[model samples]
Target: MSRVLVVEDESAIAELISINLRHAGYEVTIAATSDQAQFEVDRVLPDLVVLDWMLPGQSGLALAKRWRSTARTRELPVIMLTARAEEADKIAGLDAGADDYLVKPFSTNELLARIRAVLRRKAPEALDALVDVGGLKLDPATRRVTRDDREVRIGPTEFRLLHFFMTHPERVHSRAQLLDRVWGDHVFIEERTVDVHVKRLREALEPVNCARMIETVRGAGYRLTQQVQALSN
Candidate 1:
């Protein structure tokens, strides 16, 4: 299942799209502001973005351009959704690296079609592979985590949760975002379930002396980071 992050300010519009996307078997998340959208993207890279043209703080155009400039999100497929049908606006959006463009008052059928087309155009990567971060190693092939020549026992869910964190180390992930990514998008699990699993993951790593790396960002979310080491300028 593909994950989509819809960045729309209007609650009605966001809900409408989310409902439709979910019905179509696409895992969907709705972000109502530029800040929220950016935070969501920072948490996990969605398969595709349905971005609104006008936003409250930073314009959608600016957000798209910024994502293009950032290495992590550079190739992120985006479909600009806006009421601005002017040629200039479309061209600007295209220049901003939008994979596709859809004018508002658009039909849900067309929107779904466009999303499918964009996804087909985007290249896919191997999700199962060896990951190593800060001396902690996880091998998807072996389904094992090892540190300092010692094996770490972890549950299936914890293994996957830890895999996501290790792969995206040093970035904050909100419970909602983690649930969408780690637990399948359409999963109806509670947000607190994420906290419980995170705690379990930490306890599993405690034996390896790597538990302190997962830091809780009060009022925000959690992040996996390397041990603090001062760098010389």
Candidate 2:
């Protein structure tokens, strides 16, 4: 089940959101202050955060900005829930790294829909089905990557990158897209980070002679070709 953190200073609002989310089959946690919210995130990162714009101490905008600036929480998905419906306020919330924004007096159904949409976009690889392409196999459940039954040693980031490529084989994915999909959010992460992780993924696949499977498309991005034999040479 996807975990959701609801950060609202008002007890009634927080309880309402929490109850609705729980009823919808989501694991819900509520925080009545920015400090408590930060603590919850530090202890365990939730799949998504429903943050209130105004808080007791720090505003939701400030918290979102802080999370975006930190490497560990940079890719965290956030949806701003606030009474500030002005265009400028909405722009500021988005610029602060909110994936989606909802004003007060919002419908529960609409909020749920937005949460589902953001989670779908942010956690496309939430499924654990095995993916195989170009003789490379990745088992999300086991968290393993292999070629010809030989294990491929890789870091966490590289593993995720390879999983995405293998799942969408032969499709060229731009650096920005990769960052958004693999990193969960692209607003805070640099595009160059994709290059770094791609290099590492290739290095991990080198011993198995599958490094060339990931092709760098000129003037484009990268593609994991299904024609494994052709690239083996």
Candidate 3:
């Protein structure tokens, strides 16, 4: 399920959007202020953000610009939501890096449609395209992984896990996050399952000298990093 962050100060409007989004099978998180929104984003990157123009601390426009300038959130999809209907205001919102803009008193149906469109636009195409990170290569079309002309034999679960990690390289992903993203959320697998698969994935990559690419982030979960070097024992 895609996760969406709704940053709206109005209690009724936020709750209404949250309800509709949840009904549509999206994981929804509510933030009443820009600070809270930033806090949530810092905790875990959401698939998309529904941002309000005006907030108690800082305007959503500023927040959008900040996110756009940041490397981690540069490609984060955002739909600006506000009472402003002026053409200039809309342009400013887009300039601040909003993917789409929605004026208040908006139709919930339209909002949902726009959300779907934006997600479709921003999501990485995993089935057809080939993903390359550092020297590691994953071809979804062939379901193959190779490094330095050597093939890395991995299981189905490990293949999916590596694909996700390669696509979102350098970012920490908790076991729960990995499960939700890699394995379907409908699956009731234990978090320990991730550890087991990760170990197997590393073992498969070991033959290709790529096992060091996957790093455990201490208290965090796992990260696929491009800085692959043999660690000292």
Clashing pairs in 3: none
Model 3 residue 73 CA deviation (Å) reads 0.8
Clashes of each: 0, 0, 0
lDDT of each: 0.86, 0.87, 0.89
Q: Which candidate achieves the best TM-score against the true structure?
A: 3
Question: Can you give the TM-score per candidate against the true fold?
Answer: 0.58, 0.57, 0.72
What value does the lDDT take at residue 69 in candidate 2? 100
After TM-score superposition, the amount by which residue 83's alpha carbon in candidate 3 deviates from its true location, in angstroms, is: 0.8
Candidate 1 residue runs with Cα over 4 Å from true position:
124-233
After superposition, the stretches of candidate 3 with alpha carbons farther than 4 Å from their true spots are 124-157, 166-195, 204-233
lDDT of 3 by residue, 15-107 (tens): 999999999999899999999999998776788899999999899999999999986677789999989999999999999999999999999
In candidate 2 the C-alpha lDDT for residue 179 amounts to 85
Model 3 clash tally?
Answer: 0
Q: Sorted by TM-score, highest first, which candidate order results? A: 3, 1, 2
Please identify which of the two predictions, 2 or 3, would achieve the higher TM-score against the true structure: 3
